[model samples]
Target: MQLISTLATIGFVLPLFLALVGVLLARRDYGVAAAWGGGVMMALLVALAIRGVLRGDPDLPHFPSGHVTLAVAFYGGLLAIYLRGGLNRDRTAVPVILATLAAIALLEGVSRILLTEHTWVDVLGGFAVGSLGLLATGCPWAVRRIRAGSRLWLAATLAVATPIAFMTVGWLDGLIRHWVTL
Candidate 1:
């Protein structure tokens, strides 16, 4: 259980490190950095919204695992795009990213189930939602838009958007807790 949680937590936190790496690697072109920043922000917001909705449904009987969703949407999605040359165009990253994502998915999925944090249905739903959210943000058109956006704007957007999204999720989580207690 501890090992599983640690893996899930690592999977959850890996994207932030990847974003920093993207920044360091952005000297040649900021497209990849911009994509990483923008995609993650988008994924976080979408995952939070989905989590809120799932928690609000009294009859739903399951909480879609937010941790699992977040790990997949940000880590899995970003790594997938990076692997496909959407970001770095580095073929060498393919194996590394693929292995990392597989490990994350396995760990997160198994942990959520073992801990009874979510049912299999909930975990699967989270995975699907996360994947779709990533797909939406990682599309060619979205990538082009992110690449075309000004670097200053991208930086500012990430700075502001990331915190707001997180705060919103916190707020929503609280609201759901209150509702349940009521």
Candidate 2:
């Protein structure tokens, strides 16, 4: 459960990265890609605002589990993208995949509570925010046919750049740690 929660922690960039990369990998339309990005941004922004108003945990905002938000939006929107775009021609497997995604989301949310990371209300709030953001854009744009043709280069660049970015971050952290210790 701990590992599952940690993996699903969208932490701002993960969902955005996943949305863009998933769209590129799927060869989805620009509109669909935009919708995916918008949906995620809207959910996170709204969740953050709600957390601000509600006043919970000064140390960290946990009113809406970002773990659950991006987990659902990223995967749910991926499913929507596949279903809407007809990426997967086999209609039969869609339901099974949806169920599996839902189950994983459910398990993740439950784990958050079991681990005392969030209350039930927090989890429910996350579910609502994620779903509402996805629905607000509607399926047409979410499934748009306007293709963003620059597939290989952008994704390939990210694939190469991501490791370098991580290495740089790691090096920076080590330097910062040494300076602090001094």
Candidate 3:
């Protein structure tokens, strides 16, 4: 019980605080990206909520945190964008991103080991899926537009759709989990 409480507290505090920092940093140069990140996070939360409703999981509100994944993803994307500038060609950017990702994974792993959550796999899976979305959204065309500051519309779309995507994923997971039990 103490472990769960500690892990939960760590899960909530670290990710939430980092996300705020990420938003502020992104907003300094990429307001749209920051806003988009917010939108995506919100949508994901809603979707998770819906899934809990369908699954009749009374502890839906107490479910594992997806915001951690969001925090990692959002910051990861921003880092990728920043590195694209090639300010340090001799330096590696991927490693930095990977390290950040690994840190998040470690957090989740600790959470699971502490029994604060169900499994490390779920958090890792969320991290992978979230990163894929971040990569996809940071493609050449997307990167160019974001850098050029001409893709406000595209950023807005991402802001709106990412969360919806997360919600849908949560809903499907809930359905499948319930189905499997039967």
> Which candidate's lDDT is highest?
2
TM-score list, all predictions: 0.58, 0.68, 0.45
Q: How are the candidates ranked when ordered by TM-score, highest leading? A: 2, 1, 3
Q: Name model 3 segments beyond 4 Å from true.
A: 1-43, 46-51, 58-64, 92-97, 112-115, 132-136, 139-141, 145-182
Inter-residue clash pairs, candidate 3:
47-167
- Residue 28, candidate 2: how far off, in angstroms? 6.1
TM-score of 1: 0.58
> Which ranges of candidate 2 are over 4 A from the true structure?
11-28, 56-61, 87-89, 137-139, 145-182
Q: Model 1, residue 145: what's the lDDT?
A: 30
Task: Return whichever of 2 and 3 wins on lDDT.
Answer: 2
Whole-model Cα lDDT of every candidate shown, in order: 0.56, 0.64, 0.46
Q: Give the per-residue lDDT of model 3 (tens digit) for 36-109.
A: 45444443454365445546655443333453345445545555554544444446755765586456545654
Query: Candidates 1 and 2: which is better by TM-score?
Result: 2
Residue-pair clashes per candidate = 0, 0, 1
lDDT (Cα, tens digit) per residue for candidate 2, span 85-181: 4444456876887897677678878989999988888798788888866775455645553343433344464556445544454455456446532
